[model samples]
Target: MRSYTADYVIVGAGTAGCVLANRLTEDPNIKVILVEAGERDRHPFIHVPAGFVRLLDHPTVTWRYHTQADAETSGRAILFPRGRGLGGSSAINGLLYVRPFAEDIDSWEQSGANGWNFGNCLPFYRRSETWTEGSSPQRGTHGPIQVSRVENPPEICGAVVQAAQKAGLQFVDDPNSDTRGPSIWYYQQTRDGRRRSSAARGYLRPAMGRSNLTVVTGLQVSRLEMNGTHVSGINGTTSADIPVQIRATREVILSAGVIGTPRLLEMSGIGDKDVLDNAGIKTRIALPGVGNNLQDHYVVRLGYRVRGAGTANERSHGLALAREMMRYVVSGTGVLTYSAAIVGGFAQTRLATRPDVQFVIAPGSFVAGRIGVLESEPGVSCGVWQMRPQSRGHVHLTSSEITAAPTIAPSYLSTELDRNTMVEGLKIGRRIFAQPEVARYIVDETVPGRQAETDEALLQYVRDNGSTVYHAVGTCRMGDDAMSVVDSEMRVRGTTGLRIVDGSVMPSITSTNTNATVLMLAERAADMIRLPMAEHAASTYSKESV
Candidate 1:
């Protein structure tokens, strides 16, 4: 096995990994190494905003995982696509730039995530953002990641926004600024014109020129090399069919995301004893919480056919298609430059204190269940998702080998509370479409149709057809509880020189898109690691002089 060493060895080059790599390597004295299981983010589809449908399932860029046959959905297996490239899912996601409410961060602090309240985290969020619109005191001007509003909002999107207002919802200029009640706003995307502003493009690519940082692609980390209780290095296979060991002198950070991080821990004998035993691996820590607490937002799409001369369906096909493609190629401004969902609204399910559901308004049809080509349609589509679900699940190791995929049990709709919330979400969605201005454009409800009236019927429909919004988190949660896998500082419990810095560390799901929060967490984690050392040295000298 080829051996290597660095001050920090970060696993997974996704969103958090890229941010951590950039921040940690800023100090020239600290050498950082990042390992990614997938290849470089070089695919053309990954850059285009509308090309996410293709990149979502591309085996080269995504780890296309499927859940075990779910009991809630008539034993149907669900597809879970996660990014495997330099920018991670940020490169292939829907590109909706949203930060959850200040209350959501306060809830994290209440859940034992100390020093993670809104006030403490706001600065980090601002520090990592470089908004294209303009600089704000609340937003960063020199950050790597780019955040911008859509240049052109489709007519259907505007109608939906107006419909939301007609349905008693407020219109907000920036949803990210105030995330309270139901409010319609233009989507903030990670795009520079038609090109995606993923972490690879934002941070990693710029940091690649640094000699102190080394990035290895196609390196699937199998296990953590441990010496007693201390993590020494990572043992994995290189792209060239060679085994390798990379030692970390200071720390071994796992930025492998929710699924990959937990699986790696299980393979290293740090998971449930029964699971480890079944996989024929001797238990090292017997931590049952290592893979527990899986949470994700489930969405149900509502499609409608519209009557119009100029629409996304009209432009996606025939001669108009060629013209639109030419327009995009020439000026990078067209329907192809925006994400599938151009406008969205965040609202509370009930008369709650915080918003717990989001409505995504797309001018085009999203035919493919998980992520596929949009079907031909002149109508608009709206997807309603319940955020902050009360239900939780687990990820278990199917085998001890790295090549083997894990068994994912999301347990969607497992709780009665979650079911009730989803029913409310559906009701709220229908109300928005029923408004006079928005109602004129709708032809029919293609999804639930007119049959979904009663709450029980909608709940049944949700159990039968609900799908994840691709926001899975809280598996390797950070807290001080006995079941916590990592502490508030992201240090792995019952282990030394080990930490988890990804969405997996989130104790609960955010009220909005997870990418922005994950980036902020990594930014804060980098500072946490650096600030202590600086303070310690200064204190040591003062004490010695005294």
Candidate 2:
């Protein structure tokens, strides 16, 4: 066995791990070991803005985890693609940077995640952000991550924006300002000019040269070494299956994302007793909440054929690619800079007081059958999903082998409320597209088409078509409750020298994209870990980046 010791051992050099490594190593006195299960973020497409679609179901760069076949989704298994390398999902995500509502964070405080309210966490969000549009009382100015507007948006996106407003959806200056309020606006990018500003680029890249930071990529972490209830170290394998042990003198931080975090805990006998028993693993901690409370946004899409204008579908292939290549090389602007979605926002539905539906509009259309292939015709796509789903699910270990994938059951649309939300959300899409100003460009609704007008037909369409927005959260929930896996500071309940600092710690799903909120979670976690035990109990403002 190859053994090494560090002040802190971080598993998974993902968004949260990058933040933790950057912050923890700031004190040079502390030595850190950052491990990842996949290769480095060196793929050409990983850095390009519009090239992310080429990364789906890719051999590397993505951990394409799929759910079990479900009746709710027409007996088809849904693909739950997650980033795999240095930046993790941030490297492969839509690059659309957004934060949840104050209501979402306030609910965290209310739900027993004390001291995690918007007020306490907003400073971290601001500290990590360096907005291109400058600072506001509500927005951050000088930070690591760059948030900017899409420099060159297609005319089709503008028409859709107007159509949403014309259909009675209000436009808010900042949707995070008031999350419940319905709004439509230009989509923001987590890019700085042409490059995707991932967590690795923002946090890890600068810290890579630090003497205290040691990054070990492509290492498959197996399980934690327990000194009683405390995490003493971690054991894993290198590319050649060479055993490696990393002993942590201080703590072991798990930032292996939602599925990986809980799976690691369970493999180390830290999850539910029954689950461990079934998996043939002896129980050590028996935290039932380790893999419970799985939540994600289930989206329903609507595709429309364009008449007067051409979307990316027309430019995604053929000689058009050469033009975009030259355009991007010349000025770092064009269709090549397009994110997964261009324009979208929150909208109201008949079933809820707040804006329950979220829209992500893209200039090009992609059929479900053709995961990475754009349509041959001129088309645009709009994806709408319920902001908050009442349905709950779980991820559990099914085999004793650490490399074996655990069972993922999202239980999508399990409740009538969730099912209705999808149905009504798609109906709202029809209304927006039907607007006179927006409809003028549309030849017709090509997704569900004119035949699927009734509520039942829409519901059937949702069952057959709705898929994940790739925002999985809430397992290993953070709260003070008995069932909560982690406390307010993200310390694993009943364990010392061990903690979870990823999307898995969310008490409930946020009503927005989870990437920004996950960054905030890590920002707060890093601060808590850096402070003394006394100050850790309080909100210590460590705005080093600010």
Candidate 3:
């Protein structure tokens, strides 16, 4: 029966939600409430750089949703793991930081996001990062997120780099400098020393003590309270399952991610009329775009057993694990300090003008049947993914029950473009691994082995083994089109005092890991939200300062 109020009510304390909370609450006059479905990100593993392996599918810190059995996936249901709690997916994501190219943002501008060109987006990207490599004209200096350079580079990684060069790929200073290239580079990690610099840690945690911001965890929002199409407040249940209402005096922003955002919209009766009707709920808005245009990067791993190399597989057991633990405890640099993939490159398949495939090479392999568990012996892996997949699927409510996870289908390899590109990508990986510098380390090909050599076999391998790179987007696509759920500025269509600032707002997915892009988006959104408030506050400033 109790209700709460704030100038802004952010629905999820994930990447976007945390940024909004930190920026909006800068003004003491603005009261902000951040509601999260997971607990505070205090788990020890959440902070350790290499702790991502343990965090993936972690019941405590993740929303372990499973996709409806995708036919393209050999009828196997893929695990759709999303982060819960303060940092959201950023907390559990591999600490890889990649700035998307200006061309990528310009494409968004071309596609309908009017003011979101590379020129417009570059500032936000720079504003959100404090690159430890020092201030470059292209990189940021005094930003919240700390991007540490890869140090104590592993020899295997160097060999892989050499192999990429031997294959005629160029090594670039910045991956985001250009989109299509066969360039090898060290992963930019969002970390400082040994600790992970998740959005929660970088943005939200520092702002938690602010009087204007209130962050509540374990509050699973149920629905949006609408009055004549305007979102008046949100109805949710606390950790104790106590019903509560939180009203926003200014706006209600949904940063619940690509999956959670659209599902929450439909649950609140803000989606297609037919979808609402099927769910037995009256439609508040007939916006057909909600929960549609689902997209993701599907990757297939080519595992190779290693003989004379130190791989992460070995680091997970025996003296190797103990030594790394001690190394991290002392200096925070070791085998456990690297990103998800050690060295990745963007290469063009002969089928394309630009780089369509991303080669993610990791100095480790996973055991068969165990998704995240590392192999017992030394091994390496190269996961090839189509950066820009043409296949489109969707997320929709299955039942009226809030506890039920939405029906998610990424439609991986459903199109000719996706299928062909994946095959070419797999070939690219094989080529890179076959280079003499890198080939010497390989003992044998284990995954999809030498047997799956033909193009048809490769396609089948992708269908049976390809899974999400965890970069899901476009469900609440931002555009001027009728199919778009939100506009260029992230304002939800046909809704008042409501907006979505997350990866879901991306009109198209970026070529690399999405955290950097998401942060940039949220940073710009924060400025937009506070610009008017800042102007209003400016009037109250002393005349001398002005």
Question: TM-score, each model?
Answer: 0.95, 0.96, 0.96
Give the true-structure RMSD of model 2.
3.9
Greater lDDT among 2 and 3 belongs to: 2
Off by over 4 Å in 3: 177-180, 369-371, 535-546
lDDT of 2 by residue, 62-83 (tens): 8878998889889988888889
The candidate with the higher lDDT, 1 or 3, is 3
For all candidates in order, the CA lDDT equals 0.83, 0.87, 0.85
Q: Please list the residue runs of candidate 2 whose C-alpha ends up more than 4 Å from where it truly belongs after superposition.
A: 176-180, 368-371, 533-546
lDDT of 1 by residue, 269-338 (tens): 8988998999988899867789899999888777677775246766777788789899999999887886
**Ranking of models by TM-score:** 3, 2, 1
Candidate 3, 1-546: lDDT as tens digits: 558887788999999999999988888888888899899999998898778888888888998887789778899998887999899999988898987656777888888888888788888888888988677667898888998777867688889999988987888766754444667776778998789999998999889888777888888999998998899889999878789888887789999999999989999998888888888777888889999989898888989998888888888799989999999899888987877887878889999887778877888898751248888989888888888888888998867889988889888888998899999888888888899998999889998799988999988888888778889998999899899998877888898999999999898888778899999999999998888785554222111100
By lDDT, highest first, what's the ranking?
2, 3, 1
The RMSD (Cα, Å) of candidate 1 is: 4.5
Looking at model 1, how many pairs of residues clash?
1
